[model samples]
Target: MLLGIFIAASSAGWAIAQGAALRVPDVPYEPTPHNVVAQMLRLAQVREGDVVYDLGCGDGRIVIAAVRERGTRGVCVDIDPQRIRESRANAAAAAVAERIRFLEQDLFTTEIREATVVMLFLWPEVNLKLRPKLWRELRPGTRVVSYVHDMGDWKPQRTMTVQGRYGPRPLYLWTIGSAPDR
Candidate 1:
């Protein structure tokens, strides 16, 4: 999970003194630990030629790691511009910026159909809300990995416990179209 405070705003948007409306993020940023990031990539079985999308990517660690360690191209999506900047800087430092695209927009609105693997470290409700989009957009056999959250009623292909910053955390993996539609 990436770390940051997100102020929830109306769908219509919130206006400041400048009269410009801002679309607030649905979740806060709490970066996934480095160890968990490694496990997520392992669970997803990312490899070369794979396109990895990390929704709510904080500091772009997951995508950066995949690009560096697994030779995969990646996209980092975040609703907050600050987080996007941090991701870009981190990716640049990791020397994988050229292989990663950073998008400063809502994850739900981002185009992810091309992703061969999707990584998420979001809230439980957000994960549930994102399920249909994953099912509808991702092609068959596309792997979806989530850290510390499960899509309710959607059985995962695999689940593992990994040592995290706090303690052991659960990671989940689901291959698109592998199980019955929920």
Candidate 2:
């Protein structure tokens, strides 16, 4: 009876997931808030010509900001096709469409080795699972910035409290090779 209930729940979830490709209940879309974007960008330390990758980039605000403000090229990855479309539109509106690429792909499986800077605003568990990948894939000098969450077992090189119009936000910055144990 327990096994039957488990299967029923699993089937229901799959059906719901298929019905909502743009957003699953557990995976609601959260666009980067303006204040958080400012904080994360600062933490990213993005420079001209930098290749920035934003995992789970909802609406592409961070990628668009990077290209527009810092002269950086960016790749924005999200599992939702709707988000990819939104990001592309946002980039075009920001006039950084040519500098940013929006991709609909799993963040974990995507290649980020070429990134000079990577940004994320994801669940803590997601970051934790991605820790080893970041360490293994990113170059020594690569900069990683996270909004509201920290990479597991990896201590940030710098942290800042960003006060915004809405509220106070904490941004964490990490460098790949500097503190492996963090």
- Candidate 1's TM-score reads 0.87
Say which candidate scores most in TM-score. 1
Number of the top-ranking candidate, with lDDT as the measure: 1
Instruction: Give me the runs in candidate 1 sitting further than 4 Å from their true place.
Output: 1-21, 178-180
The global C-alpha lDDT for each of the candidates, from Candidate 1 onward, is 0.88, 0.82
Tens digits of per-residue lDDT, candidate 2, 72-169, equal: 99999988877888899989888889988777888878999899999987888888988889988898899999877777667788888776445776
Q: What is the lDDT of residue 148 in candidate 2?
A: 73
* lDDT, residue 145, model 2: 90
The lDDT, on a scale of 0 to 1, for candidate 1 is 0.88
The candidate 1 region of ten consecutive residues with least summed lDDT is: 1-10
107 in model 1: Cα distance from truth in Å?
0.8
